[model samples]
Target: MGPEAPRHAYFVPGRIEVLGKHTDYAGGRTMVAVAERGFCLAASPRQDRRIRVCDAACGDTVEFNLDPELVPRAGHWSNYPMTVARRVARNFPGIERGADIALASDLPPAAGMSSSSAMMVATWLALAEVNALEDRPEFRENIMDLTDLAGYLGTVENGQTFGSLVGDRGVGTFGGSEDHTAILNARPGHVSQYSYCPVRFERLLPVPSGYTFAIGSSGVAAEKTGSAMEKYNRASRLLSKITELWREATGCDDRYLAAALASGPEAVGRLTQIVQHARPGEMDPKALLTRLEHFLTENEQILPAAGDALARGDLARFGELVDRSQLASEQLLGNQVPETVYLALSARSAGAVAASAFGAGFGGSVWALIEAAAADAFLDKWIQAYREQFPEQARAAVFFTTAAGPAAFRVT
Candidate 1:
């Protein structure tokens, strides 16, 4: 790679979960909007089959030979870009040469804004360009669809292991495709509605005029691995466990939680009845009941009505749903900490139309829907309120207003 060689630049947007909280991995539905902040990458083709990746934000650099033997570097951020490069090499064997890639971003890492996914997408897209994969008939015929690409990346991030090979699962988060969808499919002025079980996009609901999306960081990092792994994995597994209980009790063994939810209130009522009357089981009955409550509230009401409210410009209703979603996150999901809860509540008090903590939630960022006209005042008051509580943390905390943005795309 040299300065004279042409470098292709790419932009991949970060995402904010607006309506759905901790529901994607349960094979449930969630609405997500693309944040204006995202990852940017510049790549120049190399003469050798070795990829060099530089993280501009943290000044970390990793260089790896594009080989089939690459395994995940557990607990390392560079593994993400490495995985992207490995996936490209594995899927497109003809791409012998790699690229010199440099990354930069305004998006804050560990804020539940999908900063990690943005980098992965950026690296993949850059490799796509550097290898000229689209020019190959096989590449154009198969790997060109944006949704499919997003799904593949999502699997790489959270998919389970397959024998000795570490298939797609990166870093061990076990998350679904919501973040990738928001990064790859979100359109400007619209939010994407879709389900994770079947991985289909329902529709794009428009963002109403005179409103803006505000994101407030909790000053606490939402680190998904190490200490948080058990809790995050437990939340996902509990959903499956309850669904299993429903199937066994009702003799309807072939149903997902989302499908049962679609069957309406009576269906859920039956499950609740069974749960309440059941004898002491291996799983904590109370904990199972709490999770069931969160799952039903989102799949039954908050998720379905959110699209309609946005379509009809009913932001107030949407705002109320956001608050409910947060409450569920706190009470049932147990993902919120004191810092995040206060930020959300304070933002609402400062006149945000709706406020809730979004993303993987063990203390990440919260989103607030505020009037476009009052955005500045809202930020000022929100910051003041947050800083008053923890002045030292205020330095690392980030606050900003964003709107829907287009998915990852080439930018010359």
Candidate 2:
């Protein structure tokens, strides 16, 4: 690539978890997919360890050093780009310079979508590409290098545990599951993930095509996902033990595990009870009890009243899932936000299906799963209700969707 060659920027879409909340990080089950909206990075190599970050939306140029000891803290959006530069230095050791990255994004700041991870992916890709082209005598395009860079960046940027989980290059080529957000469950020592093969995932999850997802603060959610659990080691052990029990029990009979998963199964003989079932609704408790081990294993989608849209062959089915999931998450997980609740209720009154909050709850934005045809009406209703209730603060509940997940493109 030459100076005249265009600099490349990648738009890695953030992902949404359709089912299995609080499950992924706890070694339970989860389902996530890239949302249609996300962040972008335009990069060109620099001659020093300093990466210049021009945040177009915020109109601020945050200049930071790629030194590992001086990593950025969470909620600092520039953390991702800085981490990428630092990790690259730690991995190859050959080229110790940073790059200039200018970014503008549409992904909601703190929804459960993992916008931070998406940013890492784009910055990592851009930096790697720049290195391969410019510093060739000391460079290589080894995917290992990229993965190492991502992981090191994850740790150096997000914290040590995070770097270990999703930053692995091994999973990079294959992408990741929604459960990846479970990295929140990670400790300082290690980050782990589970894999299921012959996966039969149904992806009817809707990504708000033309709209945007927004997150706001209520000042209540202060739990740092990194340090949330005091007995994380014990919890990790318990989760691991329960998972092993399922694997052994299912080794001979998978149906037993499957039936105990989604929906319900029936019919037991008086003499030799033939069915073992997991109760409907939240699957976490049953999983904790080693009674079930199956996750929804599907992508995010809107849920209409009928059923899953993909499973039902209706595009409307996708939105239906979002609507239902929002309600369920509130009832089961306790992550409900008044703002989110009000948004959904109002959206529903204005013709939306459902509305719900994101992340560890208590704060952030509301996601409304509505009929596509009713979007305009819902927005009008939300605006009106928000203005009456919170003249200044309520304006942040806005939501919408954009393009798909991150993928490599041919710049040449």
**Among these predicted structures, which one has the highest lDDT?**
1
RMSD of each: 3.0, 9.4
Question: 260-332 in candidate 2: lDDT tens per residue?
Answer: 3322233112101211332343334443443212122221122223234434445355455555666665654
Cα lDDT of candidate 2 equals: 0.45
Q: What is the lDDT of residue 244 in candidate 1?
A: 83
lDDT, candidate 2, at 137: 30
Q: Looking at model 1, which ten-residue stretch has the lowest summed lDDT?
A: 160-169
lDDT of model 1 at residue 341?
A: 94
lDDT of 1 by residue, 1-412 (tens): 4769998998889998888887777778888889888888889988888889888778888889887667758677877887777666666676787889988889777888988888887877887787787786655554456676666677667754322224544657767778888888889988889787546788888888888889998778887778877788788777777888888887875446777666665887788887777667667778889988988788668888877887888878888878888888888889988889999899999998888888888878988988889899999999999999878767789999998778888898
For candidate 2, report its TM-score. 0.59
Which candidate wins on TM-score? 1
In candidate 2, stretches whose alpha carbon ends up further than 4 angstroms from where it belongs are 1-6, 26-36, 64-70, 73-75, 133-309, 314-324, 353-355, 389-392, 401-412
Cα deviation in Å at residue 150, candidate 2?
Answer: 9.4
